[model samples]
Target: MIIHFYNILYAFYENKDIINKVNIGGIIVKNYIIIFAIEAGLTIIYALFSGLNLLNFLNGTFTVSMIGLCIGLFMMMYSDGAYSIMGHSFRKFNYMMAPKRIKETMDEDPDFNKKLRIRQEKYIWTNPILFVSLGLVIISLIAMYSMV
Candidate 1:
């Protein structure tokens, strides 16, 4: 009976299941959800094992959120090593994850700064990791609040 139930659940969550589909910024939700599950799952397991009675889980949730926030913030904080007038980018803290094309064009291309501006405008919209971190932070915060 248990084996039959297990198979049924597995079949329902099969790869072709449309109900499980979600598109976030051209990235699939399940891909990052799995990453989230691993992190959160381990936290929950640790909490349970340590007999903290959910307090540990709450701590883990906040920690995960902070981790995400830190990662996203740090990613946006520093500029890549490219053509910026010596201390300019360091002072301003412009986009850190400029594309190879943008980095390559920075020094050689006269219109690099203009292109960098445009690129920065469209920036962070395409970073899946940043999005994941943001999602983690939001979800974890919500979970933490509800738990409290």
Candidate 2:
């Protein structure tokens, strides 16, 4: 079950079309909000169900939440860089695969080229959902750590 869940998460991260559809600027803003929500939700769950000192757990939760936030931030930054490269490669592949002059000409225009680059950049760099999911995973790991 855990492995399956992890695989699903990985699949989501690997999905290029979904990443491309999302706006990078929106992603950056959404990520912070989502991460905060995930942290709060996890903290609440741990407090209610886990066998731990409420106050101590709260402290640990906050600490873990910060760590998760940092990890999420790092992932977002890394993915942004990686996506830029990957998206560029994909766009090149698409250009190559395009049929004939009409298709080729559309991709050749300077304005179109510029827009494509910008869109690809945005797609590659931003993923609010992934960050939120990662935050939850991190929080879960922290809870387990505290238990141990």
Best by lDDT: 2
Choose the strongest candidate by TM-score.
1
Q: In model 2, where do residues sit more than 4 Å from their true spots? A: 1-45, 49-75, 78-80, 114-148
TM-score of 1: 0.43
Q: Which ten residues in a row have the lowest lDDT in candidate 2?
A: 116-125
Please give each candidate's TM-score.
Answer: 0.43, 0.35
* Clash-forming residue pairs, model 2: none
CA-RMSD of model 2: 16.6
For 1-148, candidate 2 gives per-residue lDDT tens digits of 6765564467578783443343443343445565567667767776767656756565556655666656656666665576666676787777778788856686678654523333223343234444555555566566667777
Error of 2 at 134 (Å): 12
Segments of candidate 1 deviating more than 4 angstroms? 1-25, 48-50, 78-148
Whole-structure CA lDDT of model 1? 0.56
